[model samples]
Target: MNKVPMTVAGEAALRAELEQLKKVDRPRISKAIAEAREHGDLKENAEYHAARDQQSFAEGRVMDIESKLAEAQVIDVTKIPPTGRVIFGTTVDLINVETEEAVRYRIVGEDEAEVKSNRISVTSPIARALIGKEEGDTVIVRAPGGDVEFEIDQVQHI
Candidate 1:
């Protein structure tokens, strides 16, 4: 399988969730299942069925996280030498050429991309255009709305 690029922080977040699900949620569901089983026949036990469903979901999540971590290639942007070029895990400041509006975005893994948080997926159109570009460089993104031009004001490794 191809390695998936992920920021150190993104990997850490996934690890944290995995640990919580394994140690906390898994055990909690197990207890619930056991308690539900104690309530008598399993055929009519709604609680047991619900608990089993929860267990299945949690187990699936654990497997997904495990697989993702196994294939993840963590990149610590702070440790990389500052090349002034945009890359995964780098926070970039951009100015919309047409509107002159300033915006900041951090290029992150697909799992961590949250537009509200100004984190964009590395595969996003803007991020793809920004990658390998240096500060003061202008980039044009083919956004779904339309083609938008941006000026790279700064790039920070954080």
Candidate 2:
């Protein structure tokens, strides 16, 4: 499988979720299943069926997380020297060339991209245009609304 790029924080979050699922959710679901089984007929017991479904979903998630962890290429931006160049895991401050509006974005993995939080996936149009560019450089991004120009104000490795 191809390696998936992930920031240190992203990797940590996934690990934490995996830990919670394995140590807490897994055991809790097993107990629920056992209790449901004791309630009576397996054929008609809604609780038993629900517990089973939950268990299946949880187990599937656990496997998915494990596979992602195995293929994750964790990148700690803080460990790299800041060169004002946009890169994965780096937070970038940009100024809209036309509107003069300032916005900040953190380049992260596909799974970690949350536009609401200003974290953009590396493959995003904006990020793609920003990557390899240094601070003070102007980049043009082709958005669905048309082309937008931005000036790179700052790059942070935090």
Question: Which runs in model 2 stand beyond 4 Å of their true positions?
Answer: none
Poorest stretch of ten by lDDT in candidate 1 = 80-89
Candidate 1: deviation at residue 133, Å?
Answer: 0.5
Q: For model 2, name the residue pairs that clash.
A: none
| Residue 77 lDDT in candidate 2 | 91
- Indicate the TM-score of model 2: 0.97
lDDT of 1: 0.96
| Best by the TM-score measure | 1
Pairs that clash in candidate 1: none
lDDT of 2 by residue, 71-113 (tens): 9999999999989899999999999999999999999999899
lDDT of 1 at 41: 100
